[model samples]
Target: MRPMPRPAEYGQWDELPDVPEVPTSRMGDLAVLDVRERLIRLIDRRRSEDARIAELEQQWRERGGVGESPYEVSRQWVRRQTTEGALMLAGILDRLLRS
Candidate 1:
């Protein structure tokens, strides 16, 4: 096996030491707490909405809503709901950042 060459042999004597990378936090303490609260509230609201939707569905099924949907949900309704949900989340983040 050949011997390894020294770093000084290549005219390199002053090599800088390795530096540790500092992790960056996106949100400060206040903002982080606010975000956590908002997220918890959103989660609670979603849970309530889920329960209400389940109850309504059970009632609908009990009423013999079979074969086809009478008042079928439209694409616009779905899009609106999706957009509202996304916007609500975005609004929360925006508020958190603004504060």
Candidate 2:
């Protein structure tokens, strides 16, 4: 069987540009910082959403009971998913940093 040419050999894709390598320690630090920032943003977003939900719920209460709000139910589902994703990401990052 004949071997197929690699993309680089055929010029199908341009070779990547040379870039200076970052130190492992520096890279790890950067990864940790990035994760922390992302987590913070995620938490802040969730908090804002929770506050909005609370406001809406209070307003609903002010008015006589009128079944459940579809929007609120969907928002709660989204919030739950986001929380789960954040927890998983944090766990993976923790394991990576530990190693």
* Residues 25-48, model 1: lDDT tens digits: 643556545555555564555455
lDDT of 2 by residue, 10-75 (tens): 332212222223346757576766765666676676677768877877787777757765346645
Candidate 2, residue 24: the lDDT equals 68
Judged by whole-model lDDT over C-alpha atoms, candidate 2 comes out at 0.57
Candidate 1 segments exceeding 4 Å error: 1-28, 68-99
Instruction: Quantify all predictions' global Cα lDDT against the true fold.
Output: 0.45, 0.57
Best by TM-score: 2
